[model samples]
Target: MIIAIDGPSGAGKSTISKMLADSLSMHCLDTGAMYRAVAYLRLHGDIPEHDEKSLVQLVRKTELNFHHTTSGTQIFWDGIDVTVELRAPIISQEASRISAWSAIRKVLVELQRKICGSGDFVVEGRDIGSVVFPHTAYKFYLDANVQIRASRRQQQLKEQGIIKDVKTIVAEIKKRDFHDSTRKDSPLTKAAGAILIDSTSLTKAEVVQKMIIEIEKIKEKLGKKGKTN
Candidate 1:
């Protein structure tokens, strides 16, 4: 079974998804990291911002991999570990832009499908529940208020020693949110039948536990139907 968790930035999707995957003993696929990796590579290369054709070509030639370890999820691009490099703010901003391209999304969607085909995975991304895995066994959409989201992001940046004013971070987040929601290809929206969870005041453990309850309900329903048949 596959669990799809979709949400915007700083909504606690990553932490929740990782915990949920570990509890279930399943693989966790961080789709956002894949886009970030691409963005990181593009920033270091000759790829232009508006060159969709070149971007598509670059994606095809690149090999992206995700590995789950005792430490955490590690991302690789063409066999090079980029776990730390992809976390830069520059790459984060560029990732939000690159992911809006339809051609790039198509390639990544295919890659995502192939990865989840053979194993149980907790996959999280903007479109994971809505587009990438519409038929997934469990789908969740996590969200929080814009201000709260911005605060969380600000705290994260501060911890990384990339200090910035709250106003600036909030502005940047709002800009990215607008682009993500209004993008033509695979705009971020909750999938039909997805359970919505607002993390405005919820702790990380609380969110994970709530999702676990939902997953249990799904398992019960499936099991009952199977026994009836």
Candidate 2:
């Protein structure tokens, strides 16, 4: 059973997906972090992001592995721990920039599916449901108003001691939305049959509870069909 949690930044996809995965006893795959790791690599390594061949070669050589730590899943790139570094503002922008490239998405999406193929997974990303795991019946799209999302994001960064101007963050979020929604290869969209949740006023626990209820309903329906068949 593969569950997809698709949403933009600050929509609580990452937090909720991990919680949902734990509740369902499934692995959590953070596809957004995967992209962030790539961006972090290139930014520090001085790799040419504009060159498709160089990008592809770098991706092919970069060994990205996930480790289940006490704090949750941590990403390691080429034997170095990069989970904390991925949240840097520069890397976040770079992730959004490289994610639009066809070469980068192709490499990461393939590897993402491979990681989750053997286990029940709660995979979260912009295109997890619409592109990465389109065949899965368990799909969710989480969204909130732009201002609320910006506020949430700013607070999160503040808690991390990274001070970013709220207005600048909001502008960046809007720009990222435009790019992700307009990208040619796999644009972000609500997948057919996806359960949409407007999380404007919901807490993370509330959202996870709602998601659990939805998943149970789907599971019950699938069970009845299996018995009838």
TM-scores of the models, in the given order?
0.93, 0.93
Residue 210 error, candidate 1, Å:
0.6
Residue 15: error of model 1 in Å?
A: 0.9
For model 2, the superposed segments whose C-alpha errors exceed 4 Å read: 68-71, 224-229
Alpha-carbon RMSD, candidate 1 = 2.3
lDDT computed for candidate 1:
0.85
**C-alpha local distance difference test of each model:** 0.85, 0.84
User: Model 1, 1-229: lDDT tens per residue?
Assistant: 7898998888988888888888878888888888997787788668987888887888788776778753357988889899888888989989998899888899889988998887778899999978988876699999999889989888888888888888887898789889999999999998998999999999988988999998888878888542110
Model 2 has a clash total of 0
